[model samples]
Target: MPVVESTTRRTGGSTPHRAPGRATRPRRRQTSGLPWLLSLPALLLLAGILGYPLVRMVELSFQNMRLRELISGRPAPWVGLDNYTKVLSDTDFWAVVWRTVAFTVVAVIFTVVVGLGIALLMRRVARGVRLFMIVAMMFVWAMPQLVAAQAFRWITDSDFGVVNYVIDKLPGVDYQNHSWFVNPWQGWSVITTLVVWAGIPFIAITLNAGLTQVPKELVEAATVDGASPWQTLRSITLPILKPLLIIVTTLSVIWDFGLFTQNWVLRDGHPEPQYQTLATYSYTQAFGQSRYSLGSAISVITVLLMLGVMAFYIRQMFKIGEVD
Candidate 1:
């Protein structure tokens, strides 16, 4: 009998063989251009609508576009960096910048703190109470900014305002015909209060939604492990909520930094020098004083500042994502 060849190799065992004509399947691409292609039309439309105005504003910043040039419809002569130089050199402009920053900081802090508190309260409340709170907040949020501003204006009005009336009701307190806007501190207080009030609903609702994602199991575990409420919140809850906190804080910063309508309406369309913010300053320069170029330069600077803030928040978000 002929000796049979062994199929198994000596090192390991029998070697597995592929079928003669089978081809390996190729992997699908992890990315595709289809999404980008589909998005092109909307992107182009936005570019046309928003991009042109931004470009025009930038172009205007480099030119001497005064009332005369605007009226004549003639091309304004380019003045290079003179507008920027003038704006930067003005002490009043710097004052406005500092004021704006201060207001933003205070408003954002108040909004976030109070909003977070309300969100936590919502979590602990009965279903009916929570529903009522949500509906009330929705109404508040749905109210137009202008309407809200106007309402605040009326409430704080010097003559026969409810705020003064309520204060006057107290013994030894004379608030009759009291003007809230006479002093800068009082005026800014009113503005900040309005901002915080209007902003809280959105922040609370968003944070409440974020709070829903917190793991109940982890919370219970912490409780069983003898963690106090504060400790549990600080360690377990906060870490989970960090990402959302960052987002809401960033949004609040952006909104408060660009404060315009409230201050404008509160001041009766003519804010005193001390009351001027970056938004109002820019508006006053362009429309009020016809210094269009200077206003454009200020606006460009404002955009750059906001961009800086956005960049910082975006970096933070990416870092959190990596950790996750």
Candidate 2:
């Protein structure tokens, strides 16, 4: 019998054949540079708007930019690290730093805890009650910081203030014409209360939104498994909400660490040393004391501190992304 050659042709004489599905599988397209190109204009605009001032501030921090130089339209003489040295050496500055750190810690803690509680409450409340709470919170959030600070100031006024009036009405309390700011602790308490009250709306609303994303089936499973409410929250809810908590807490720390409007306005635009935070301290140094360079240094330091917080936030976000 004659052997006939096979009619089929081999594409690759030695290569193994690939399965149809594997052969047809599409590769993921590389991410395009169009997105970066499209965003260039906004990035440039922000650089001009925000970056210039920041650079100038740093420049000023290295100089002796007194009122005289500001008025003379002449460049301030460079002073190298003298401004930083002066600021770092001042005992009062250290006191202000400690005070600012303490206030931030207290304010952030209260804000996050209270905000979380309100968020949980919102989840459990009747629809109408929840709506009312949301509306009230919206109003508070919409109100300007200046207005809120003024309102709090009026509320805690030494004379003709409602807080004193209500306290004095108690059976044996003598809070009439009480001065809240006379004591630093009391003043800080008031400031903290204002900060927490103002902050809760944002945190509560955001967390409540996150709560909606929680799987109802998982929650039900936990309940069916005889998990107490606290246990469920501790085990399930908190772990899920960890990302949101970190975000809000970091933002609260940044805002409260730079406590300015509330402290300045409450103290009538002249916060005493006892009540001074980094922001107020910077302003007091620059405008209040005409130490522009020193104030710039303080501001630069404050920015550095905020950057540290932001870095931690970014790191936490990366961690969450990795976990997901």
Candidate 3:
């Protein structure tokens, strides 16, 4: 009878309940919330900075916020989608958009191709030469767009430019007095060259980093199996580096699409209205002509286009991941 009473005391009425291996439901819930709680501050900061400005820009895009209204401290009149309608209906706006697209496509394609070539070459070079090449590329990459434009202007000058002098020396060419910026196409060619040259360093460096991760054994095995260099690259290296290539290409497209400083500085303030990019065109509308609302609309369109490209890029990346 004593043993039975002791057993009951130990088993039920007096013993404290404890879970040794697992946490209680409430404690698990608290742990789950901790990550979100920790992230709240950063999220709020981003919302205040990035989110607020984007919202303000969208609001301003639909308003008549010309320079005069701003100067007079008047509340902007909301005009619904008039700004977008005006921009969309304008032939010049469409022309600029097309020009921007063409320039971006050309620049990104050349940059990626040349960058890949350079990365491949770097792998074959001696250590010392590779270092020198990397340093030179970094120097080019570090140059500001404005500074590079100015430098190129000096190089491509009409009378005393080194480029003209070189052209004069070339067979069947006498361009010593050539004023490159006078012609829109010539100006564009110069801009493209400068853009490609400036962009190559970043692409090459990033691609080289990606290349390092590619196994030498795989390449060697492919070589031993009678695969040509081009075949191996097409079948192996390219597939491995696809993600990095996409990232770099997308970034290049975005950067080149919004090209401003190079084109503007190259045009030298005598900008041929016909040759203006979306960025230059928007600036012209807002500050040059005091059409703030119209300019905001253009800016918004540019942002939307970029977002679309990014969305497509992300979708492609996910598809590739799923396939892998």
Candidate 4:
């Protein structure tokens, strides 16, 4: 005798017969949609703020948008790649590009090294180190850039600066009086000092968090295997820290590229500055001379640069993931 299939009754119709060949999986109930739903609001917010503005910026970059256009209420003429070509040919733009790259590289290296050392020191100390580090870092980082720049300017000023005064008092160290901002080298010195001061805290904070995640067991095991501290750090800590290092380095690159306030205040707004940066150059074009299109062009270039750096970072992450 053949087995009869079971039938179940429904609210609005006659019983439907069930095919009882085998038990089926519960439709693999998707949880991916749940996470997407949870994240949708944040994604929308990010698109609204960053994505929309960037789209508008790209659009405006291609157009000859200006005060005249705005005042006359005329549609901006699409210039295609004209602005970009002009910026590329400009000598001032190149100078700014060089200075910006140098500044970012130097500042990032200084910040990362100093921060890593500080984090290590903070980790070693058991008594009130946290409070001291937090207070010290916060003091420098919390100050307004303008205020810090002004204070530093006064401190490093040739005429009345305490630094020069102290130098003057010192025995036989080239006591030639000079304004620190008078030369390109001096300008970079001031800029680098400010960059290091502003950057070290972030590095220390990030590296310290990374250091915390490094397992004590791993360290002890390495020690038991006759690995020195430096060796252990090289072999294990650094490898484990790849992700955090990538994040820190990428952010540092982006931040340092757009360095403006410190450099500006260091030299106090010279239009034809000897040590111009792409950002400062763009600012001068837009605000100093009201050349909106040129400024927008510079900004578009910067966005491209940032995108390149971001792409490099993503590639590195993918490589690391594959290695893991």
Q: Which candidate leads in lDDT?
A: 1
Candidate 2 at residue 12, lDDT?
A: 29
User: How big is the RMSD of model 3?
Assistant: 7.9
How much lDDT does candidate 2 score? 0.91
TM-score of 3: 0.85
Which order, best to worst by TM-score?
A: 2, 1, 3, 4
Candidate 1 deviation (Cα RMSD):
5.3
Error of 3 at 289 (Å): 0.3
What TM-score, to 2 decimals, does candidate 1 have?
0.90
Query: Lowest-lDDT window of 10 residues in candidate 3?
Result: 22-31
Once fitted onto the true fold, the runs of candidate 3 whose alpha carbons sit more than 4 angstroms away are: 1-45, 313-324
Local distance difference test, each candidate = 0.94, 0.91, 0.90, 0.82
Candidate 1, lDDT over the whole model: 0.94
What is the number of backbone collisions in each predicted candidate, taken in the order shown? 0, 0, 0, 0
Ten-residue stretch with the least lDDT total in model 1: 1-10
lDDT of 1 by residue, 1-324 (tens): 122225353444656679999988999869989999999999999999999999999999999999999999999999999999999999999999999999999999999999999999999999999999999999999999899999999999889689999999999999999999889999999999999999999999999999999999999999999999999999988899988898899989999999999999999899999889999999999999999999999999999989988997888888878887
Candidate 4 segments whose C-alpha is farther than 4 A from its true place: 1-45, 174-177, 312-324
Kindly list the per-residue Cα lDDT of model 2 for residues 43-101, writing each as its tens digit. 99999999999999999999999899899999899999999999889999899999999
TM-score of 2: 0.90
**Model 3 C-alpha lDDT versus the unseen true structure:** 0.90
